[model samples]
Target chain A: MSRSVKKDTLLKVAESLFYEHGFRGVGLKQIINEANVATMTLYNHFSSKENLIEEVLKQREERYWSYLDAHVEMESDSPFILAAEAHGRFLKEESYKGCMFLRAIEDYGEMDNNIEKIARGHKQKLLEYFQQLAHRKGKNNEKDLANQFTLLLEGTTSMTPLIGAEKATEYSIAMARTLVQHTS
Target chain B: MSRSVKKDTLLKVAESLFYEHGFRGVGLKQIINEANVATMTLYNHFSSKENLIEEVLKQREERYWSYLDAHVEMESDSPFILAAEAHGRFLKEESYKGCMFLRAIEDYGEMDNNIEKIARGHKQKLLEYFQQLAHRKGKNNEKDLANQFTLLLEGTTSMTPLIGAEKATEYSIAMARTLVQHTS
Candidate 1:
């Protein structure tokens, strides 16, 4: 494979494997073999497994935010509402596992600051997304509104596996709406 | 050491280490050494490392629910409210780590049904506790009420480290109160 194709292949294979079995569950050799790439090719593209993990997270994070952005504009609704809808859809897909960012933090947040920072930064950016949405709604208390919306969104992500995805999404969107519109 | 003392010591030490560095991060030998018990005694108490993990989780789950129960009755408040207060207090403690149940689920939920069941049961029982609280408050839609409260509680637990524990707990409790009273 060309260098770029090799890099993309490594990331795609690694992301799927990591999502299915978690970051800690898969090793570099597994990723290399699964990607069908040479060992040095893997090392040349991403210097270390940690570096690869971070890149995977960064790619996933960008995809998540971009998805939400598209849905937000298409729906012409609050980002909080749109994001929950997008997430619920994500959960329902066949390959859906739980949130990778939260999983990474759960697996390696304590031992590695870089991993923890990636997880925390993703969440922080999510909160900012909500803040911008609240601002667009012309709410004076946008910070509090953003906080409430973010909590509901976070709750839905965590609860979707336990409660069926459909019901969890419906309930969370209702709760988020109540928070945003102040209508019970 | 007496068998019971050895068992208790093993549990206490294992719980702390697991909380600090996830379930998969620690090993049987490390737990045994830290607990200062003979290898044979450790094996005698718990047949395998998985058994030890289940016991540690069970013990932590009991303490968590009991703590919420005590605070619930003492404050005559919603369990959602009281639990947030207790959890915030926990976060402020020097040894505070993320929620062990969620961490366990994140780590081993896919491959290990026993671990997954314990984590799921802990969450299910928490939802039941909220249902009971909502029933006590004379809510007709107890299930929905319980769902909302539990979501906020779960969100706060997950978000505490991202947003400061104090802020996360305060915001979650405010949302919970609104859900309880239907007052915006």
Candidate 2:
């Protein structure tokens, strides 16, 4: 089989298991079993379990960031609206367990250089997006405003599920708008 | 040993390991070893690993909520101000790994009924606190305000490290203050 085919299969198996059972709960044997591949085959595709895990994180990141870009465009969406839309998309996901970055941070334990870099990059992009919007609005401290917005965005994500209804996405929109309204 | 002393020792070990590592990362074996007790002794004191975990959650709950209550009673801390002080305490934690609930939730794969209950209970209290605060402030839709406030608190906790900043807490305090000011 080609590398792409093998890699795809591994990602599918790993992502499901990791998401369902958490990174620490699932093990190499289980992944191999679920993927229907021999240990050597699994290792052949990815150098080690950690690398395979990183690939899982990478796939989730790409899927999410691209989705965010599609949602928040320069041509449309006021800063508040754009930020709220991102939350909406996340809530729509059937697999929206929690923040992938949080799960990655939790599962990766001692963060590998690549995983940490990827996580940092994703967060930086979010901050940048919010900061750009604040700058567009002519906030005195765009950076500070952007950072505050990110906190509320994050705070909403966490609070929603715990808030105990399906209103997580909606709650985020309200909170995001409120936070943005303050700075603007 | 007295039941309270025995329980206290177990809670200490559980908190240290759970906070430093994670719930899944720390096993009963390790907890017992750290507590300096034989396996039977561990079983005798706590009904099972799950119960021990509850004790861990309970201890975390008490520590956090006691602080929350203290602020709530300060007479000067309007609902919003009390809420801000609570956020300040959360941010000032020495480790700042993440929210205790998120930490437990992340590792709590295949949720147990009792664990879920404890998690839900802790969240319920927080929301109630928020709601009561909003009510006291005469904020319209006090329930909604509480939901929004809870979301910000939770989101910031998880988002802090992802965004990789110490300012998350500061932003939380400032934003929380703004929320109270505007809502009040």
Residue B117, model 2, lDDT: 77
Question: Model 2 lDDT vs. the true structure?
Answer: 0.70
**How do all models score by TM-score?**
0.87, 0.87
What value of lDDT does candidate 1 attain over all alpha carbons?
Answer: 0.75
Docking class of 1: medium
lDDT (10s digit) by residue, model 2, range B1-184:
3465666787898887877666777888898888887788778878988788888788788888777776665345566656665666755663356676655654563466576678778888877877777666566798877777777677667765664335766776677766666653
True contacts kept of 1: 0.44
Q: What is the C-alpha lDDT of each candidate?
A: 0.75, 0.70
Writing each residue's lDDT as its tens digit, candidate 2 over A76-145 gives 5465677567756765672545666666665454745576566666778878887788777777898888
In the range B1-184, model 1's lDDT, one tens digit per residue, is 3359889999999998888766767787888899999999988988888888898889988878666766666336555577667766665552234567876776676785687789889989888877887777677877887787777766776676566677888888788666656632
